[model samples]
Target: MNEFLAAGLVTALVAGFLGGGHCIGMCGGIVSALTFALPPSRRHPARIASLMLMYNLGRISSYTLAGTLVGGLGQLLVSNLQEVARILSWLAVIMLILMACYLGRWWQGLIRVEALGQHLWRYLEPLGRRLMPVTHPGQALLIGLIWGWLPCGLVYSMLILALSSGSALQGALLLLVFGLGTLPTLLLTGALARQVTSFFRQPLWRQASALLLLAFAFWQAMPLLGFARELPF
Candidate 1:
């Protein structure tokens, strides 16, 4: 269990870090809007930083909750019908591959999958807009919580990994770690929007991050592939 948790932590952190470019593409606009919501006089470095921190913490909390729910479902499934483990693992791999392709600029098939959430987002988006023109920490936090549900293939891919963990605690921890890894990039983006966005939007960054996602896919597949060494009798 300890080894499993450690591996999960590493995978979550790397995935989150490498997915920075995607994060910028998906959430940078939202960050920009929030940044601009402040009154000119209130936009000091310290004040902006604190609000961004609240936003990210709220976002990460949502991820953690999602992981807990999905991971718990996985646990229930695996416990009752052990064969389900194999199926869930494969699904996770497929999602990761699709995510990698999308991130790497190889293909953008995942956008169709992402489209599935639009119905829900349509309702939530209005609420998010209302919370905007943020004037307080509470409002910023609420905005982050709402935006956390924004549909992104990258986030869904990570959620799949959490589901494969087959334990609510593990899943929550995995997503928490992933969220932390993403925190620095987003916080910086809030402070220096154009510069940070331009840096992460680079083709090279996208491709490299895609490679990392592919590696994570393979890592998850290693056990299912039966790559464990045979005993030397």
Candidate 2:
């Protein structure tokens, strides 16, 4: 991969990791519910691990699919209107900054942004419910595919970054890495929800993560503004 694509993927991963606190609050309940839905006999430690793995695979696949579509749109803009691509990149930087603010609790505006997806989610949620009390990993996978569409500000913020990606492949890769980054927190939550939540909830950690993301946003913005500098990969 080229330097720009490499950096984009790295930034996407960091954003997902740093946004763990938010993800916990947004999806923790659903994860817990899914875990409990497994039949008792299938709730063994190894079995639970398998189920969680399938669910996340399904969720991340959805993210990759979304990224592909948005990235294709971005590719079209870049092909036809280079200036528009630049403008969208700047907008993506702004969205990243806003994401940092939301992560740090400095502002809640992104919550309003999440409203954009609610209408679609309303339709998908019942289908997800139908797959509940999942007996097989396949069923869990299907449910997770649906659950990935649940509206969240963090996900939307990342989508903006995906859109800024110049090609469909890069956009899909960016989100794929992002989904992998989120896997740790979400996968572990079933076994260590309290501890993981407490760690991410600490003010020091949250602020530090927010600052890191903000710095990344600035780095991305600088290149767009003709202030490019070598970034350690």
Root-mean-square deviation of every model: 3.2, 1.4
Best by lDDT: 2
Candidate 2: segments with Cα more than 4 A from true spot: 39-41
Write one digit per residue (lDDT tens) for candidate 1, span 1-233: 46556666777898888888889988898788778878898888788877888888889998899889999998998899988878887888899888889989899999998898889889998998988788788888998888888898878887888887789998899889989989989988998898988988899988989998898778877778987522223
- Candidate 1, position 183, lDDT: 90
Candidate 2, residues 1-233, lDDT tens digits: the string is 67778778888999999899988898788778767876787678887787788888899999899888898899998899978888888888999999999999899898899899999999999998888777678987998798888898877877888888878998899889998989999988978878988998999988998999999999888788888658575
Q: How far is candidate 1 from the true structure (C-alpha RMSD, Å)?
A: 3.2
Which residue pairs clash within candidate 1? none
TM for every model, in the order presented, reads 0.94, 0.95
Clashing pairs in 2: none
